[model samples]
Every structure is written in structure tokens, then in C-alpha cells.
Target: MKTFLFRSIIGIFFGAFLAVLFTNAIVIFEGRETLDGALFIKNSIGSILCGWFSAVSPLYFEIPSLKLSQQTALHFVTLFILYFLLAFGIGWIPFTWNSFFITVLIFIVFYLIIWTCFYLYFRQQAKKLNAELTNLQR
Candidate 1:
């Protein structure tokens, strides 16, 4: 419970930071001076929720009965839905089929990149641990 709360708080802050950075970039690119207060608040909340879920979703993997693939699928779908809704709601993407397709493609690419990185890292760690165990058994 403590760890969960800690991660949630971390996620909230991360979300807020990303929201600010994203908003700034968009403003600069569009030559905007400022954003509407209500819009800013809405975006901030959305980002926070996304971040919170991103952090907490990994807990799904702790279920011993679930295969790795199942956990991964659930995590992917949950995040995708949350992000798609948020992006569409915030007008970051248009309500068109083409836009949705492109967004999904981009999301999948990024998700794969991240997932692969983590997989390789953990594989490496497992190898190191196995090597250590072999040495100890000698």
C-alpha cells in the first residue's frame, strides 16, 4: 500500500511535469501567448490520471496466475484506451479515422520500444543472477 501510494504520487508529479512541457511546446509551435485557464486545468487533470494509471498498471503483473502475455496485453489495452480518450478529449488528435490510425501506430511503436528495452534489461539481470548462482553452487 505504501509503495502504491508512493508510485501514485510520483506519477502525478511526472504527469504534471510532462503536461507543462507539452503545453509549452504546443504553445511555442503555434505561436500562442497563453492557454485558457480551464483548458490548462483539464489537460493537467487528464495527464495526471494517465500518469497515475501508467505507474499503477504494472501491479497487474504481480498476479501469479496471470501469464506475462496476459499482463502485458491488459497493460497495453488499459493505457491505450486511457491515452486515446485523453488525446481525443484534449483535441490533440482529430476525430477522424486517419488521425486515429496514425495515433495508434505511433503509440504502438513507442510502446514496443519501451517494452523491448525493459525486456532486454531484465533478461540481462536474470543472466547475471544465474551466473552468480552457478558460481555459488560450485
Candidate 2:
């Protein structure tokens, strides 16, 4: 429970940070004259909620399995649903087949990038631990 809440809070802040940065960039790029304060507020809240909901998958491990692929699948599925809701429910993306398809492609690309980073981080940590154990044995 504590882990879940902690992770969720972290997600909330991180998501909001990214939201601000991305939205602002888009606004600037599009040459928008003025920012809609209400829209920004609504979108930020939605993003925070998105983070809260999506963070559960990474911190959750009730299955007691050792299969990395299975764990990754579960995580991806959970995130897919969460992101779909965030996009379609919050009007972040249009309600069209083309939009949905593009959203899915974006999700896949980001998921793979994030997963690869995590995998590399874990591998590095494991290597460090193995080295430490080897040194202790000597």
C-alpha cells in the first residue's frame, strides 16, 4: 500500500511536469495567441489522474511469477487501458479511427523506450551486485 501510494504520488508530479512542458511547447510551436487557463487546468488534472492510475502496474507484483515477458505484458496492457482512457475520455485525442490508431502507435513507441531503459538499468544494477559479491568472496 505504501509503495503504491508513493509511486502514485511520484507519478502525479512527474506527469504534471511533462504535461506542462509538452503543452507549452505545442502552444509555442502552434503560435497560439493566448493560453486557456481552464483547459490547462483540466488537462493537468487529467494527467495527474493518469499518473495515479498508471503507476499501479509497475509497483504491483501480485502474480508471483518469474517470467519477465509476462510481467511486461501485464504492464503494457494496464498502461494501454489507462492511456486510452486518458486520451479519449479527456478529449486529448479525437474520437476517430485514425486518431485511435495513431495513439496506439505512439503508446507502443513510448512503452518500448521506457521498458528498454528500465531493462538496461536493472541489468547494470545486477552487474554491480555480482561484482560486489565476487569481491566479498575474495
Candidate 3:
């Protein structure tokens, strides 16, 4: 129960972080502007959703004694397919392949960063939890 709670909290945090980072980057680099309140809300939701999705994936999902090489390969393949499909899908939406491709590229990079940060944060938390468990056991 405690582990589940911890994971949930981590997922939420990662989601918020990802949303804000991407929204801000878009504003700065793409010269895009959105209404303050709406933008904030949208970004917050987006980040959380993406964060949750990533956390749920096997790559980011927590598991003990997982084989690093296999996990990494799996992550790479999944992400590659996901990004490609997403980009193509977005292009299909508006019939704008070039624009969608560029957007996907940007999103991919940002998502990668967010994933790394969340993963590290969860890892550290897990380490702390393990230590506490060990101490309690001792």
C-alpha cells in the first residue's frame, strides 16, 4: 500500500514537471502564446497525463532485479514506435506531416528529459525506502 502511494505521488510530480517544461519551451522557442489561465491548466493536465503514461510503461515502471539491457532495448523500441506513430497520427489530423514531425521531435526530446528526471527521482526514493526497510528490519 505504501509502495503504491509512493509511486502515485511520484507519477503526479513527474507529470506536472513535464507539462510545465514543455509548455514553457514551446512559448519560448515557437513564439506561441496561450491565455495564462488556460495555458496553465492545459499544461498541468498534459504533463500529468504524459507522466502517468510514461510511468505506466514497463521502462519507467518500477520492478526489482529487472535486466538493464533488456529493459533498455525494450524502452528504445517502444519509444521509437510510439513517437513515430504519434508524429504520423498528428500529421494525419491536420494533413501537416512536416509540422507534426517537427513537433514530435521536440516532444520526444522533452519527454525523454522528463522521463529521465522522473526515473531518477523514483530511483532515489526507492533507495531511501529500501534503507528504511532495512533499518526497521534490523
Candidate 4:
């Protein structure tokens, strides 16, 4: 519980940071000085929630009965729902079918990319541990 709380706090900060960074970039690109207070607050809150969920979503994998595939699918679906609803509510994406479809595509692409990177990294770590174990047995 303590570890979870610590991670949640970190996630909230990280999420807020990313929200500010992205908002700033958009403002600059659009030749605007700043976002309005309400929009800023909404985005901040949404980002924080998203971040918190992202950090804790890995707990799904801790279920011993769940296969890796099941864990991954569940995580992906929940995250997709959370992000899609938040993004739509925060006005990050337009309220149109086309916009929603495009956003979904983008989300899937990024999610797969990140998932693949982590998978490869952990797979490499597992291989290294196996090698070390073999060396120890020799």
C-alpha cells in the first residue's frame, strides 16, 4: 500500500508535467499565449487521473491466475477506455466519429510500440538472469 501510494504520487506529478508540456507546445504552435483557467484545470485533473491509473494498471499482471496475454488485454482495454473518455472530455480531440477513429488508431499504435519496448527489455533481462544462473551452476 505504501509503495502504491508513492507510485501514485509520482504518477500524478509526472502526468501533470506531461500535460503542461503538451499544453505549452500546443499553445506555442497555435500562436496563443496560454490556456484559459478552466481548460487548464480540466486537463490537469484528467492527466493526473490518467497517470495514476497508468501507474497502477500493472497490478493486473500480479494476478497469478491470469495469463500474460489476458493481463495485457485487460490493461490495454481499460487504458483505452480511460484515455478515450478523458481525451474527449478534455477537448483534446474533436467530437466526431472521424476524429475518434483517428485518435483510437494513434492510441493503439503508441500502446503497441511502448508494450513492445517493455517486452523486449524484460525478455533481455530474463535472458541475462538465465545466463547468470547457468554460470553459477557450472
Most accurate candidate by lDDT? 1
lDDT of the candidates, in the order given: 0.90, 0.83, 0.65, 0.89
Give residue 126's lDDT in candidate 1 (0 to 100).
99
Q: Write the per-residue lDDT of candidate 4 for residues 85-130, one digit (tens) a residue.
A: 8888888899999999998999999999999998899999999999
The better-scoring model by TM-score among 1 and 4 is 4
Measured against the true structure, the TM-scores of the candidates, in listed sequence, are 0.87, 0.81, 0.42, 0.88
Measured by TM-score, the strongest candidate is 4
lDDT of 3 at 55: 56
Model 1 weakest lDDT span, ten residues long: 54-63
Worst 10 residues of 4 by lDDT: 32-41
Q: Residue 5 CA error for candidate 3 (Å)?
A: 20
Tens-digit lDDT track for model 1 on 100-131? Answer: 99989999999999988988999999999999
Candidate 1, after superposition: displacement of residue 131 in Å? 1.0
What lDDT is reached at residue 136 by model 1?
A: 100
- Each candidate structure's count of clashing pairs: 0, 0, 1, 0
lDDT of 4 at 120: 95
How would you encode candidate 3's per-residue C-alpha lDDT over 10-37 as one tens digit per residue? 8789989877787779889989766478
Candidate 4's TM-score reads 0.88
